[model samples]
Target chain A: LAKTTQPISMDSYEGQEVNITCSHNNIATNDYITWYQQFPSQGPRFIIQGYKTKVTNEVASLFIPADRKSSTLSLPRVSLSDTAVYYCLVGEDTGGFKTIFGAGTRLFVKA
Target chain B: DVKVTQSSRYLVKRTGEKVFLECVQDMDHENMFWYRQDPGLGLRLIYFSYDVKMKEKGDIPEGYSVSREKKERFSLILESASTNQTSMYLCASSLYLEGGETQYFGPGTRLLVL
Candidate 1:
């Protein structure tokens, strides 16, 4: 499993764009970058996933660099309800199955 | 939508008492997982099952056991509840996909042992 490092916490306001970056220096070739969001007292929800370059979905976008050493989760027009913890994971198959929940980045969307 | 339901939302038990945490998924995913969340420890995997009657220990499996008799249901058992075991227990299910595997989680069970 590739160890991931993310910001402990972040602050954002409504209508603002929030970007959270995760570092996985030991990322493997087969590993994929995936992100999840968790609100208070709720299960984490899947946001976006990508293997390389960029991938966008209805909720957010994932930007992976060419090196694939890091990835960024970009949320547009954030709202107070967007306050939650975001996790970035890098793994494949069974290896990915483990360590799905590391210390995630806590995003605080202020009013 | 994938729905993972836990047997209980909140549970209170006494020390030396047996405890069972049940998790059921509607999507019939092949993989089911049990994890415990603490203040700073994040989420630690207790056990997971890839197929019926098959189980694997996760990062923290001490004092914990699991049973998966059916595809959709997975159970986490504690032989004897202890105060140190008091924490938020979570259940998740996932299926392997092209891009990656995404886990669907349950609301969670907050267990308290005294």
Candidate 2:
């Protein structure tokens, strides 16, 4: 299992774009990068996932470098409600019990 | 829109008591997992089941056990709960896709042991 490291906290104003980066230096060849967002008192929700290059969805975007050792999660047009803890995970396609979630980046969107 | 439902949102239990946490998913996924989330620990997997009646231990499985009787239901059992077991218990289900698997989580159960 690859351990992930990210910022403890971040601050952003409403309508601004925020990018959170995660480092997984020991990522495996078959591992994929995934991002999840969790609000207070709620379970984490999937934001985006990617193997390499960039992947975009309606909620967020995931950018993975060629080495696959690092990834960035980009949230566009932030709002107060977007304040949450974002987690980056690296694991195999069927990593049921092996998926590791480290202390995620807490993003505070101010209005 | 995959939905995972937990048995309780909040629970209180006494030390040495037996605690059971139930999770159900309607998506019929083949894989279900049990994890505990702490303040700085983020989420630690307790156990996971890939199919019915099969389970695998995760990183921190010392005080926890799991059962998967059916494909849609997974249960976490703590025989003798302690104050240290108090935390947010999360249940998730995921289907193995071609490239990767995306886990869908329930609202989570906040367990407090005294």
Candidate 3:
């Protein structure tokens, strides 16, 4: 498993854009970058995933650099409902299923 | 939509008592996982099953055991519960993808042991 490093917390206001970066220096060639968001008491929800370059969905966009050692999750026009803990995970193809979560970045969205 | 349902939302157990945590998924996913979340430790994997009756120990498997008799159901058992085991228990299920697997989680079960 590739270890990821992200900020402890971030603050944003409504209608503002929030960007959270994650560093995985030991990322493997077969690893994919995936992000998940967790609200107060709910399970973590999948936000975006990408192998390289950029991938966008209805909720957010994932920007992966050419090196693939780091990735950024960009949320546009944030709202108070966007306040949650964001986790960046590097998924590896180990012929089996496994997921390890870190402390995660807590995003505080203010109204 | 993938729905993972846990047997209980909150549970109170006594020390040295056997505890069982049940998880069921409606998506027919091949993989199911049990994890415990603490204040600073984040989520630690306790056990996971890939197929029916096929189980694997995760990072923190001590004092925890799992059983997967059916495809959609997975159970985590604590032979002897303790106060230190009080935490938020989470269950998740996912399809087996090559590069990455997107896991859908349940609401979670907050267990308290005294």
Q: Which docking class does model 3 fall in?
A: medium
Query: What tens digits encode model 1's per-residue C-alpha lDDT throughout B1-114?
Result: 999999999999999999999999999799999999988777888998889998989989999999999999999999999999999999999978887888899999999999
lDDT of 3 by residue, A1-111 (tens): 889999999998999999999999999898888899998778889898889899999999999999988999999999999999999998776546577799999999988
Output the TM-score of candidate 3: 0.97
Model 2 CA deviation exceeding 4 Å by range? A95-97
> For model 3, what is the error of residue A40's alpha carbon versus the real structure, in angstroms, after optimal superposition?
1.4
Best by lDDT: 2
What's the best-to-worst order under DockQ? 2, 3, 1
Least lDDT summed over 10 consecutive residues: which range in candidate 3 chain B? B94-103
Per-residue lDDT of A91 in model 1: 71
Q: Backbone clashes per model, in order?
A: 0, 0, 0
The segments of candidate 1 whose C-alpha lies over 4 angstroms from its true place after superposition are: A94-96
TM-score of chain B of 1: 0.98
For model 2 chain A, give the 10-residue run with minimal summed lDDT: A91-100
Q: Rate the local accuracy (lDDT) of all candidates.
A: 0.90, 0.92, 0.91
- Choose 2 or 3, whichever is better by DockQ: 2
Query: What TM-scores does chain A show, candidate by candidate in order?
Result: 0.94, 0.96, 0.96
